[model samples]
Target: MGADPTAIVVGLGLPSDVGTGWLDDLTDGFRDECDLVGAGVAGGDTTRCDLVVISVTALGDLGGRAPVTRSGARPGDVVAVAGRLGHAAAGLALLESGHEGLPGPDGRRRDDPRRDDPRRDGRAEPYGSDERREDGVAGLVGAHRRPRPPYPCGPQAAALGATAMLDVSDGLLQDLGHVARASGVGIALDPGAFTVTPEMERVARLLAADPLDWVLTGGEDHALAATFPAEVRLPPAWTVVGRVTGGEGVQVSGRTVGQGGWDHFRM
Candidate 1:
């Protein structure tokens, strides 16, 4: 729903060996982010555990407006997204690939002999500072470290008469499936509509992965996706990606796509 967050309550489970300094740093991070949104840490509980565990409950205010819900989407509504899409996933891929350890223009930390040789088994490996800057891999890494969801856009969508709204914490397709199911309407996405950054494209090339896969199926970007009336003039932050139809399920360019995304239980 499109609501403004007001407060957060944290539940922390930490091992007994953890130091006070570590705890302070953890709490400080939460406070810093909450302060950015004018929210505060209301209260929380802590306990000893085998591993660190965290649970957060966020409270929000809808102002005087009715909450925008997934069930409100109807046929003919325009589906749009605000904020990023695949940056986090691409960043994670870079980290997982051990690219962060490569030296030189890559900005990776480690010094490897391979850095001078550049070739493993006669295959050309892509590396260099100019390419890194142009692709903006560093920025992608930062995006993963701290996802910047368009918080204010939530209320903006609500004010603009968004029929259905949700933050795309999971993959876009999976989260949109929730709206499709709840509203009993179908959503058809345009493959050409999504914006894939150069950094994402570069990462995909290095990994031999489709950038669209990251955009459509990768999770944790936390971009806001909403459905608005066709007549609504969305702000510059929102990009129209799809449309609602009089059916059930989500599709892209006339083909049905799987609702594959982050599932905490499955994980």
Candidate 2:
């Protein structure tokens, strides 16, 4: 749990025309991350490929503590999340739908000089514009373009007796399902436990979608979701949302989720 990070072997695939900007960004990004986690750059390689791909292999020294793995979760463990969920999915939706004028930092439509913006007058103005991707509204697009995961939280959770842990690189329910399957347990998720940010609600209204669905199934936020013993007092970094039980698979609000999350093999 108190592992000191070692080298990071990164493999980059990209189009030659795209140049070194991505590589530079990757270098700087990994440097920042390594610095935060007490790691150093070892070496890496770059190659031209059809699409940009980054494979980061992180090696570390655990300082003699056993690794916290998914299989350790027990029936009585409490499920928790380290931070707000569903932000990345909402941001991607905005980008995919070409939504501009995204909710500002305050979760309100960015007030533009257009003056006649209907949302300003409390109307459900039609969404989908290129402007949201512009520099003016950076919150959503920023998440889509780059992720800011709480790295230090991992060690904290580990030291605090987290039984099982993983990054929310995929959707919450989808990732939790992995824990359930590996631990041979069931997870009961309470959607009401999540913090429904105004941006999620705004996106839901704009797309006529369910905010809970996004929160449960949206991916790429990189927040940590872990399981701890029932008696553990989780720090402020985490909030309880569910619990493990004797069963298989996962359920939300007492109903089985017929489908959840994304598969790289097939959408």
Candidate 3:
């Protein structure tokens, strides 16, 4: 299909385990939900074509709204995120352990309230302890293979009086530093203010890693990091992790958080 200059862009890829029918299903799903710009596959004549490549580009109109860049965050604006975080990182651990299911140390399955229906309960139970571990592995695998951006959060921030915004591609602390540097401000994140979920804390305990560090330093959560006016009412999905201050760097409880994001050359 031809591209639409006035529509937003959406991208999709075929999973490694995905068959042709699954790819078709994904494409059809995208068409039903979004105005896709273009879709196709790419390859080269090599002895080993180990990966299937798919790329998509989306063009969107802002309807005359001013674009909110990282430079606009100011002191007193609340810093927040509007989607899931750290699950993929937790999942990666499970996959690396070669677990087939999600089970806690005691053998009780971690209940996911999102699956409240009784009929769906059967399917949800298997996703417990070991199953959860497996899902976590699958999640991290998916995250490494493909990243799903919270596109709406960007536009939503703009619509909801967000002063500044950026996607959380890197670790939260690192990305917030970007916002801070760009806006010529400092951020003070409150670890006490953070409410770690059970699954996340459990994963952290199981991995023997600090849950706070995972939330602070582990990246690829893809949640939206935005700065809103102090008085603005944020949605429930949003978490108040830190605050913007009048300065030039970022800090966690007054201590400077180092810039430790992904760097190919350094690695």
lDDT (0 to 1) per candidate: 0.78, 0.71, 0.60
If the candidates were sorted by their lDDT against the true structure, best first, what order would they fall in? 1, 2, 3
Score candidate 1 by TM-score against the native. 0.84
Regions more than 4 Å wrong, model 3:
1-51, 104-152, 260-267
- lDDT tens digits, residue span 166-252, model 3: 777677778888889889998887777765567667666766766666566556667678899999887776788888998767777
Instruction: Give the Cα error of residue 52 in candidate 2, in Å.
Output: 3.9
lDDT of 2 by residue, 1-267 (tens): 224567788888887777676556556667765665667878878898988788888887766788888888998999998854776677678777767565565667753433322223333222222124333334445555555566667777888898888888778888898888888899998878998776677777887767676678777778889999999998887899999989888888787655533322121
Off by over 4 Å in 2: 1-4, 14-18, 48-51, 103-137, 259-267
Worst 10 residues of 1 by lDDT: 118-127
Error of 3 at 101 (Å): 2.3
Q: Give lDDT for model 1.
A: 0.78
Clashing pairs in 1: none
Measured against the true structure, the TM-scores of the candidates, in listed sequence, are: 0.84, 0.79, 0.67
